[model samples]
Target: MPTVALHHESIRLHTPLPTAFGEIRERDLLIFELTGADGVTGRGEAAPLTPYDGVPLDVCAEALAVYASILQSYDDDAPGVLMLDACREAADIPVALAAVDLALWDRAGRRAGRPVASLLTDEPLDAVPVNATIGAVDRQSAASAAAAARDAGYSCIKLKVGVGDDAGRVAAVRAAAGPQMLLRLDANGAWDVEQAVRAIEVLSPAGLEFVEEPVHGLQALRAVRERVAARVSMDETAEDMGALIAGGADAVCLKISRCGGIAGLLAQAALVRSGGAEVYVASTFDGPLGIAAGVHVAAALRVQAACGLATLEALDIDVPEALRVRGGMIRVPTGPGLGV
Candidate 1:
């Protein structure tokens, strides 16, 4: 096994990003690094926001400790799947498993002298289109943010609704962004079925691309979907994919940590696509490493819709060179591994 080390860090956000769940002012990350005998190192991050995912930070940290121990028992040349399976058996926590999986993939890509995306698929896109997020709740603030996003060359924008004044805020954003910009909403499962249907009906005049997690659970999602012409997407339901595969949503949002890293995310995306629903990657406000993993996976899959990876700006930390978003698109880091 390669040498393993773990570090904890808290990164402050540029501004408090408000959502239906709560406001996030800081992100806690478990940074994991693996160094091979040859002196090559690969990195991964485990970010657990308890308010969003219900996975406590210490829980994931403890699970990662177990995974590190499991890794030590393996040979330096152990198969990735074999090692990952062992870790999963020991601790079934997705967030911790995500960090281990990413580190392993990063090490493999570095060894093969290829980008992670290229290793995943025969053909991979050089870049993937990304959507800017507008977290402001008031009409003027939301409009100003939307206009700025449009002027910055963002073709798509995701607004946080189900907070308050949903109709007014959406209208202001629409007026500011114009009709051409793709508008999506994330309610964060704030509404019940009837409330979601009513909200979607009122907001659909803005020409929505989709509404994500308008209501919680598969049954509520199906009820809302039945009444709304606007497409409904699943985000929080990723853990309940058994019901998701039955086709209640028009799209499904897959996150790196939630899906247990890149490999598991791809496997889940396959299942989502098999059900005839579109699948796309979204960030859980992760750091550079996690965001880079999302880009690689989206590039390999050639996902058409704009992804939710343009989130680095929300953090106060410096943007890594390879993970920079250009003209509403994130270019796949051509360097070996995550290229950070």
Candidate 2:
């Protein structure tokens, strides 16, 4: 039989992470460790961002405990199968199941002496480009941040909008970044159909790469996309394949915790791609371990667009073995499992 252990930690952010939902000053992470009879261990993390992830911390913790108890009765011969069963049973707790799903993948990779990316796909990418996020700020501050990000070698920058003079902020960022930089915007579902259409129209001249979750529902999303010239990407509204396909957005953002895990993400990605839409891998301000899992997923999918994985800097403390970013790119971990 396999044993599971869970640990909880709260990390204080050096700088308050701002989003359209609110400012986040701290993050709570639940780490899980699964030890097999052979003495080999695997690790996973569950960090739920409230309002955004839908699942509360207390709820995820409870679900994880339930998952662990259920897994103990299963044979240790196939940890992956056990994880799948647990995930199916705890389908309501997607984030908690994601933690176990990743941990089991880690265990399997270690046992096979191959990286998780290798297991997911045969065509592994060397690295994935990351987008530097400019949190909601005033026009001047947004411009300065955009300039700094460009100077730091980040070719892609994601600007948070839907708060205070959004059009002006977009213009300032575009001016600072110039035409060469890939600029994207995330409204975090702060706008209505009218507001989203107006905002997208006003900021369309900035040459945005795409706008994410500008409005709430699938109907509103389609309306905004129809009214605006810029491409639309769905995040908050993309809960399932049906929603993603019906949302009519050009792209859908995939977060491992929200999508169940690597397996779930791959399935969604395939569905979205088959429908002539693109897929982007994003994060929930997770710690290093969770971020590493995202990196492997991005590599396995051979993502061509910039991903939202350059968020480790938002955390005050990171795992020592976290993946490193350079020249706006994060190198894929080559070691067995989720290397970091």
Candidate 3:
């Protein structure tokens, strides 16, 4: 059996990130460290932003306490069995379960002396393409940020829409990023079905890669996706796999915490692809450990779409330099475990 320990930390963003949900200026993250009997330790992060994902930090903490107690008595050598047992304990709290899943995977990879991606897949990518996120909503600010991202060697950019003047900001960003660059928008389910259709139709001419969560619920997403020529991707509305497979959108956005960690992410990715939709990884302003875990998963999958993992730069805290985005790509950490 392994011992589990928990730590809490608060981090502030360099600037407030404005989205359709609300403004995020800071984050309280929970880190879980799992140490095997052999004295090897693995790390994971649970970042819950109530305004973003609606999961509270205290609730995750309480779940972790329950998981910690269960892990203390359970003895399983097989990684799969260990994960299943751990997940059963924190099944209700996916965010907290994510921490345990991550730690287990990290410990497994470290024990095997391989990177987590290699442990998941036989062919892991050396680097994964990533997208720069622009938080600015106004035309001038959005255009300026888009231009900066272009100058910084980003080939893809994601902007938050359904906030204010969606058309103006989209047009501004398109012009600044040039016609060749891939441009995507996230509405955070802020609009109604009619509003989402209208917004997507109005913004399609600017060459949108996709519109994410334009409206809440699978049925509404399907309605909007059916009417518009532009592609639609589900984010917050993707929790229901049964409804998601019913063909609401062209793609789905997944996060580490939301998916319950790498193992769950792999399962969801398969489900998304089996339903004939694309799956891409994103972050919820997670700390370095969480972001690193996302990178490894994306690398193993070799997803075509640029992932939304280039978000660590938004935080004021220092992360591993290796996790930094370069040339519009994130290089997979090559060391054992998460390598960060």
Candidate 4:
């Protein structure tokens, strides 16, 4: 699986998915074709479960344009290697490179007659917990969305924040979802350290599981961690192992697309989760391709906290899923590669 080709998709979503951290306007799909010497093609996507993580749709096309030449050198059997090389050269935007990398893996999976999960050397399908994410614009919306998730059989729910109504919004979601559900929030770097502290205090009494990036920047993040009630996890801030270690993050948020590939994301998970930092394998509102990648990584690891995998409830279509959640426990995708 050495060579590569590109494709695109237009997906219509229900509405803009919102949370304390960020919002998704819509998610376009991307395809990567990894061709073998025999001319088989494998397809994969790189979009996050949600459209946050700072990856604008236009940036992906730009990434393809810039790295077109270097990617052409590799043959089909080397889809993984070809993608790795591109990632090394185009380090600034791993999300774009992820499309190529996963597509290569998908192609290689086809060549080997296995799913993406089977091709991963590090994974054999470990079980994990999954939380359903509900995207709503305000507390009223949050509350309504939470009820829908509860009805859908999700045990835990995560809401987005970053705007001013943080406390009331959480209250609305919590009240609607009821007390039995575990709640999480994502702020999308909307507050300063001081404001983050005040905001968390307002909501923590309701029993939050954790908070994702209440403030922006690495330094400000650590400062807010000192002040807030909910434990802080790094999402947009921790792109790689170096950043994860350097940022002093208590929890490392692993999104497959943002990490560039499942293989690399698994590597970072080993370093961060094994070292006692909280590791959550989640997605960025990516298409099914990206969701499968994150599911593979999370499915392979032993994660305690329920993941943000619930974000997929909002996607227009489904990708490969490694596991499903029931009563809060996440199931591991059972198969050769990540095609579960």
Candidate 5:
């Protein structure tokens, strides 16, 4: 049997990470480690945004404690069996279960001396394109930031809207980014259906790649999608597989922390694809380890759209630089396990 260990830490960001929900200065991260009797170890991370993911930090900690207890009773010699049993036992706590499941996958990959990406798919990509996200700022600042991102070699840029003259902000950024750059707007479900329709109408001239979660609920989303020329992607509304399928979104955003682990992400990706929608891998502004996990999943899935993984620069600190983004693309780590 393997011994399971859980560790908690608070990581500070270089700047306040502001979104439509609120501003975040620090994040609570939970790291789970599973050690085999043979002494090899695997690591995973759980990052929950309270009131956002609807999972509190204390609840995640408690779930980890429960999972630790459940894993102690498992006598399975096969890592796959252990993973299955652990998932079944921790079914109620999906986020907590994700931490454990990710660690198990990492352990399995390490045991086989292959990277997790290779284990997940037959044709994994060597590099994946990533998008730079600009927080909501004043018109002048937004324009400057968008220009800087474009000059920095990022071909795709996602701007945080839904606050203080969103239409003005979008216009400024589009003007700065020019026509060739791929532009996206994430409102984080801040508008009513009427407001969304009006905003989309005003901003559509900017030529957006997609507008994410303009309003809450599937019905509102469908309404806005019908009225707007720009494509709509769902974030908060598509938190689970069922909501994602029901939302009828043009695209679905998958966050590993919110959607369980790699396995959970893959399942939802397949479901969204089956329903004729594109799947995008996104982040919760997690630490390096969690971001690395997302990168591997994006590579294995061969995600064609620009992913939201180029966010480590927003943090003041991160795990030793295990992954790097160049020319708006991230090179997947090829080492054993997560390659971190």
Candidate 6:
């Protein structure tokens, strides 16, 4: 059993965009490499996801460094050894660890000649529904995007909130999307508790499905949830698998980069089901690797809700056909080890 070495890559989106006030040009993906004693190689990628909690590049570089720095002291050939499980649970480090951890799992699945899904979540699901992401744009643009997503077959839609005219913007989208679309909101913890409650109260009438991370951290999250009418979800405050389950969250936005990796995601899925709550595995606007890993988890888990899968389009790539959305749903990959 030779060790698996974790690696990373930095790639620009092949394009750039301004959404909701920020410019995203590139992304950091966690790629894991497993080298067996006989020299066989296997690979998996962690979703280089960004959060409201930390700087994107800094988080990824720090994650890669954990593997690199430890390899200097820990043998490269002996994998999964001599590390405290809770090595760094501060905020975003778990996501970094998750990227490497998932890649290793991908490597293992490939080496075993089994599909990552079968090894973990079974076969491809019929379809994992999609929720279109409406970014930080004005009402007209956001409405156009949401309508486009609906035309693309998406049944649910998510809006990035907490900017100006918070209620007005959400209401515009809801009105344009009509009364049937499953509407979700992510404030990225930008709104204060009072602001969050007011926004949710105003939007709930427009058929808001859920609002994520209206305020920062667990305590504030709890307070908002207690007071607000909207179903409060945990996005930024969820760090580890433990936090994903125990942060007193109603639902968690599971990002592969947050928990550790594919293996770490599996660990979190277990936590989600065990906690008797729902999980919405989202994209950190990551590339294909993290998205694939998340697809596997979404398929395996008892997720009845739509996931944040529409974000994948923001990053350009020819994704696997199995992962492509049709009728607003994407099926999990059934081929061996995240096959392209």
Evaluated with lDDT, which candidate comes out highest?
A: 1
Worst 10 residues of 2 by lDDT: 316-325
Ranking by TM-score: 1, 3, 2, 5, 4, 6
The candidate with the higher TM-score, 1 or 6, is: 1
> How does each model score on TM-score?
0.99, 0.96, 0.97, 0.84, 0.95, 0.83
Q: Any idea what lDDT model 4 has? A: 0.69
Cα lDDT computed for each candidate against the true fold: 0.91, 0.85, 0.87, 0.69, 0.84, 0.68
Query: Which has the better lDDT: candidate 2, or candidate 6?
Result: 2
Per-residue accuracy of model 6 over 93-141 as CA lDDT, tens digit each: 6556665555556656666777677776444464577788776567887
lDDT of 1: 0.91
Of candidate 5, the 10-residue stretch with the lowest lDDT total is 75-84
lDDT of 4 by residue, 42-95 (tens): 566756343365666677766765555566666544536645676567645777
The better candidate by lDDT, 2 or 5, is 2
**What tens-digit string does per-residue lDDT give for candidate 2 at 22-107?**
98888899998888888878788888988687788998899888888877776667648655775567656778878888888888
Runs in model 1 with CA error above 4 Å?
A: none
- lDDT for 292 (candidate 6): 73
Cα lDDT of candidate 3 equals 0.87
Q: Which regions in candidate 4 have their CA more than 4 angstroms from the true location? A: 1-3, 19-23, 48-59, 65-71, 90-92, 121-123, 126-128, 240-242, 318-336
Off by over 4 Å in 3: 76-80
Residue 228 lDDT in model 6? Answer: 73
Off by over 4 Å in 5: 81-91
Q: Per-residue CA lDDT of candidate 1, range 18-116, in tens? A: 899999999999999888787778788899989888899999999999888888888778888998999999989888899998998898889888999
